[model samples]
Target: MVRQTLTKHPWWKIGVIYQIYPRSFQDSDADGVGDLAGIEARLDYLANFGIDAIWLSPIYPSPMADFGYDVADYCDIDPMFGDLDAFDRLLDGVHSRGLKLLLDFVPNHSSDQHPWFIESRSSRESPKRDWYIWRDPLPGGGPPNNWISDFGGSSWQWDAATGQYYLHAFLKEQPDLNWRNPDLREAMMAVLRFWFDRGVDGFRIDVLWHIVKDVAFRNNPINPMWTPNVTERDRLIQRYSTDQPEAHEITAEFRALADSYGDRVLVGEICLPNDRLACWYGTEDHPQVHLPFNFQLMETAWDAVTLRKTISDYEASLPSFGWPNWVIGSHDAPRIAAKIGEAQARIAAMLLLTLRGTPTLYQGDEIGIGEVQIPPNRVRDPQDLRQPDLGIGRDRSRTPIPWNSSAQAGFSTVEPWLPLNEDWRERNVAAQDQDDNSILSLYRSLLALRRSHNALSIGDLTLVDAADDVLAYRRQRANEILLIALNLSDEPRPLLLPENTCIAKVLCSTKPIRPISSTLDPNEGLVLELKEKS
Candidate 1:
């Protein structure tokens, strides 16, 4: 068994968090697109599963260029998702179920169609022209810098009318804001205050580390192992465009706004690897984001040692200011069930919840949903069509949720915005609702177990032993001690237990297990409660 420990904090103790990608979650009107009302109507199901909060991916008004990530209006709801009243209802519904709601805040960029950007681009002398990053072309008619967009091609989009190239790290339609401009920063803060004043619980900031760019607009060096077709931005080292020092300052401002409300939180999405990722939490003088979404579980290789090392390294690297978090699935990545196979998805979920940090669950993962195989002819994402060799087919993971066996998978009267998976008839919420052994049921039980025991909620993570494919750990807080063990292979493995302790099998993804007499079968996982001798 490998041992680890965590500092006890309020937000870090959250039991279970559910991520809702608005477009594919549900459709309230037969329009075949999900709206805020759709989520409100489904609140009971989420609450029933014992989820503590729901992270709603960007729902702000957008042109649908990059779904809702390209914000046209930071304060208003998009017609595709619904109006203000619908979101108000959503908050009421979520709160009624004892759950909190988190909105996606895209602070790094705004849609070119946004009012501020439109005015900025209309003329050089416009008041809002400073809102975006615009620079003149080099002498040879090339871009001023060699920054590459995350979606491929040059990060600069040349504007013929102004004879300048505007910086856009993602899409040309979404212009990167000039964080060096204090006016723009103040405006973004006002937007956050506006939402908070309206009672928003918190925000899950999008690409929070990409807020500031290298001041000199210098060219990024070519990566030694750079390959054009593999990653979206692998051609360059991205030294000048991401994870700038000003990012921490911006995050501190965001955290302060959210901290105004005692229970509010801010979760940042920093995609960099773990070594430098922990710095986003800020230093002792200021607190950065509440929970920086750690993607180690999603990025780690599917091996016992790799996963164990990732978790252990994160625990060791966490700064004294902010809490640690773990995410196995999200909107932009493939489903966890598909990544590790259906049998192992439950085990992954078990480990995520039983571990030391806050756990985030992507929507539709509870019932063993995998990434759908979308054919090239039916591909919808521009990224997939634009760069076929990249194999960044996200539509496979963004398919509409399978609520029931009904036509359209109970998602809409018309065809969904994205195609529903063909296997939805058999693998859906309706079918799993009645089966205790189903993944959804297992998730519900896991949430209940985590909440009922303080040890599981906010306890220290101490690895007892780790050998081959078997790993064991203890979660302790005061008198409660919870030992979690996993048999990560097909063959049976013997696990060493704590001496003079009575083992009580509290939860397991497979068959009911006892500590000594019962052996964990292949892909079997367990959470055992321990009682010390008098």
Candidate 2:
């Protein structure tokens, strides 16, 4: 693991991050695909949109096998997304508005089309032969072991020339890099430095936990608790193939590299539970990711009691130096509006922004974007394309953002890569920007409140027993004491405050800011100034 650098600047803890799925974010070229120029044109929109940072998903040159997750070249931009000149201009525009830009880094693997992998696969005596994971087939002429791919197949792909198989955790076109190779590790580190030199603020590392694997090449055991109804990839436990101890050392190296750039952050995408997830923070002396992406909110049940337990447990379990983060929706999951209905999504906005730590808002959740149905032929996600009956496609959540009611929803002149929602005209940025009661306005108000109030941004949290259907927490930093009460049920729930305590005033609410009340209307939440009795 890497050593600590005395003190750290807490931009991640202090600000909100917005994830932009590049292809669906904005298409300026009108070529049915989004590009850096598109994002550059919209810098003012994001700045006024109230986010502190914009994390762009994989803009590296790729063949788009996994929608840019498969990196063919790390040091340059894809022609489809414009050239390096476009990226530099985008960076300049972002900093001009006092906002940060974080690029997505995929350290675990590279596209098969990458020169390093191509050379490594050419012959056994190639200079870069050891740069990738390649092994001889089993004695019985099967895969090296029983390991499975995330995209529903064997992780090994046979190479015709080398007479060996290479490991690919996802698509066969994406080869896993050999992190154990010192030369390979240095090369990847150089890629990080290359981007840092270009003035990018941070990175959101993709699939961080699966980067390393077992040395013995042992078969993973069958999952005892897995059900047939679950994803096919979960049929076997990933204990042996994933979450190796060496992964921490690799991440620490990344942390050290990022710290060298001064104030740049490393956000890891790890989907493990809280206890196991804590390891990514490293021990007290050495640290790993600045913020291991917290996906608990996306996975938790939509209710007061459930979310309360989740937040409390996560907060308590954090390592001493580790800071927490929250994600409501993302390119991978269903949007919040569709998950629990639009009304509850407003309460969700209050819950996300008012929480103690930093929050990440998905691109479209602010305007209450729901799921868009994709027909069989139009589906782009490989998961659904592979298993059409499972109904687990991710394309619905990743539809193009509806800016206006114009043709292509103002995203493109031509048809978008993914279809826009049918309600794009009714539920759009142009429509919501004017409506004070719109979800977009609620998000802005929450962000403004968060920025204006020190207590909400950096404060101690104390959970109160408001009611079974209501969630209440007090945040206090010195004299700035406030209470947040959320009604999670469809019916009105009375706010049951503790003894000798009363709300001074309601600062904000799902409906409207009003006088302190004993009960919250159905699906409403209140941020209140609190007063304690003598």
Candidate 3:
């Protein structure tokens, strides 16, 4: 059956999103960091790349404790990145190029250095004492509960002056805000309006699921499946500390606020199982986020059988009004090429773009950049420093983008905040743009195909029966039908066509040359037009 496209579909529903880690994208000034002006300079590159919107990581005033995630001032731009004028210019450039811009909205926490937090911790009777989550210690003067921070150790920090323990889901330097406080909620909502008034398109809300916590401050249950392989935070199930039912009310409020500014989109960063994740969409009568970011592709096993089931399960778990979005990599995760080999990364790219939903492409993935090896002295991530044994540092994937085969990969005039990929000299954008068979060229082709075909961008997906190593799916929209078959194994696999279906044309392939037969080469993927026998 043909899936009907919404008559008034927003740009976000039909458009592709490209996520840019601001510190790694480009540097306009000689400084070692990327700034808003640097992003403005790269507008032409992104505009021509066929992305509908750009989702930038946090660039607000911060102390760099958590690399901008610990926001000091939500309503202002960071001096290290740029001033408000620079941000305005960047937004102007993005909108002029017909591209939307999304800022990283971090409402769950703020830097301990923030004025509000400073006052909240000044004394027990401070005016803003209830602005942040603070509670008296247990009878023995320990933490209030057994909850653990995402970084490590306890989720609470002792405030000697206030004689209380404050909650911090991340580092101790970043304190969680009290969403239960009506004043705090109003203040955060004003931050959103501030951006909206300045012409900002929308936001990607960070840790949307952690906005509201359990009121009782109960201890988390012990995780039976915890092991030495994972980080210490997984020792408990986090049942009470996160994904509270009240969080939905905040999302609904956010949705209403965004609706007032017609055409604005809200993308939530939520990490949960498919069933629970679907709940973020709210009911048909009261929609929440436009898209709840899905990271299943990054977390799932890379085999065909596993991926096929993952995709099907996610599709089945979505609410009737919930729109699906996919992510293969992010600043917090390893690159696709690093997780899988370069060859399989190409196949994964094809799978990502062909799926029946919005796709968010991480910067530098188009050139097949792998994870850079970060030295101990250069590590900037607190997650890695606190838990070195777990190897959870994200610096490897947060390296600078290689624009040309020059010193520092043309990302900055000085040394970059993070190291560039080792092969930056050869695998840069300039070099790849000149090679017809390069990964960049394949991405360009795939994006162009997706833009031209309705069956790819907004079509109904059907899983086609295939061997264990081959993931085959059909996308159909009225008379248009496209078959995507990906060989996930190291050996060649024959295409298993469905009953009475025939290949009409080979539109694109991951290999340098298009496949001429039904057999797909190792780690290859193909997009083919299909027809039914008379």
TM-score of 3: 0.98
lDDT of 3 by residue, 1-534 (tens): 222455677788778899999999999897889888888998998877788899999999999999999999999999988999999999999999889999999989999999999999988888899999999999987999999999989999998877889999999999999999999999999999999999989999999998889999989999999998898889999899999999999999999999999999999999999989999998998989989999999999999889999999999999888888998989999999999989999998999999989999999999999868998899999999989889788999899999998888889999999888999999898999899889998988888887788899888999999876999999998999999999999998888887898989888989977646778888889999999988
lDDT of 2 by residue, 1-534 (tens): 111221333667778899999898889887998889999988988888788899999988898888899999999999989999999999999999988999999988999999999899989999898899999999989799988898888989998878999999989989999998999999999999999999999999999999889989899999888876767789898887789999999999999989889889899999898998988999767889998999999999888889899989999889987888898999989888989989999999999999988898999999998868888788998877776777778999999999999999999999999899889999989999999999999998888887777788777889988877899998998888889999999898888776787777677888866665677889998888878877
Note the Cα lDDT for every prediction shown: 0.83, 0.89, 0.91
Q: List the residue pairs that clash in candidate 3.
A: none
Candidate 2: misplaced stretches above 4 Å? 1-9
Sort by lDDT, best first: 3, 2, 1
> What lDDT does model 3 reach?
0.91
lDDT tens digits, residue span 219-338, model 1: 999888976558758878988899898788878888887777777888899988776788887786788887888988888887677777877888989886556788888888888888
Candidate 3: where are CA atoms >4 Å away? 1-7
Which ranges in model 1 have alpha carbons more than 4 Å from their true place?
1-12, 499-502, 512-518
Per-candidate clashes, comma-separated: 10, 0, 0
* Best model number under lDDT: 3
Against the hidden true structure, what lDDT does model 1 obtain?
0.83
> C-alpha displacement of 36 in model 1, angstroms?
1.0
